[model samples]
Target: MIKNEANARHLREANKAFKAIKSEKPMTDYAKAQQSIQENRERLKAERLAREVSSKDAAK
Candidate 1:
């Protein structure tokens, strides 16, 4: 059936994508630095949001 063929094609594409991701090399130092910065930014943003919420609750 046509549906079956489409499903097979989708699976093949997905497998190829997974293989490509598995083949990637390790991150360079610059990439590591960028990832570290991104993680720190996310952590800081969460802290800032928590502080704002607490302050708003206190002011009520």
Candidate 2:
């Protein structure tokens, strides 16, 4: 019954994918790997500050 169902379906799927990929900020593998290093530095800094606070409290 449908003459252009395959073409129409392909169009719809392609259009649906366009939006999902549109807003992505592409990062290379090295960039993605470096992000974790920054995160770890932040985490370690927070942990060091927490320990310092606890040590000061214990000293008092």
Candidate 3:
């Protein structure tokens, strides 16, 4: 037979997940994204430099 404890545990988990997702911020629009353009550019620049460094090291 199913037990009351099992049902409570399931409900608690479901509600916890629901609350977490509900609390998260939604996607940002282009204007909001542009606000972070400088940060994004720096991140991409760092990635490209890292790749170049690795390639030069491998060539040696």
Candidate 4:
């Protein structure tokens, strides 16, 4: 029974260590660039939509 408990403890500790390692992976440079580009695209799209709405309101 004691051996089983020790094995469970070791497994839990190992899982916690591996989970920490997996969760803290740094983003690569290419991924960072892609994320930046996506953010810029979304911002531009929002601006364009706002402009179009204003223009339509002006025409009315």
Winner by lDDT: 1
Which is better, 1 or 2, measured by TM-score? Answer: 1
Model 4, runs deviating above 4 Å:
1-22
Q: Estimate each model's TM-score.
A: 0.62, 0.59, 0.43, 0.62
lDDT, candidate 4, 1-60, per-residue tens: 999999999999999887845465689999999999999999999999999999999999
Q: Write the per-residue lDDT of candidate 3 for residues 1-60, one digit (tens) a residue.
A: 378889989999999887755465665798578868978999999999999999999999
How do the residues 1-60 of candidate 2 rate in per-residue lDDT, one tens digit apiece?
375998898899988887565576789899988998999999999999999999999999
Top candidate, metric TM-score? 1
The lDDT for every candidate, in the order shown, is 0.95, 0.90, 0.86, 0.94
Residue pairs with clashing backbones, model 4: none
Q: 1-60 in candidate 1: lDDT tens per residue?
A: 999999999999999887755467889999999999999999999999999999999999
User: Who is ahead in lDDT, 3 or 4?
Assistant: 4
Show the lowest summed lDDT stretch of 10 residues, model 2: 16-25
Output the lDDT of residue 60, model 4.
100
Return the lDDT, model 3, position 1. 31
Clashing pairs in 1: none
Better of 1 and 3 by TM-score: 1
What is candidate 2's local distance difference test score? 0.90
The parts of candidate 3 lying over 4 Å away from their true place are: 1-32
Off by over 4 Å in 1: 1-21
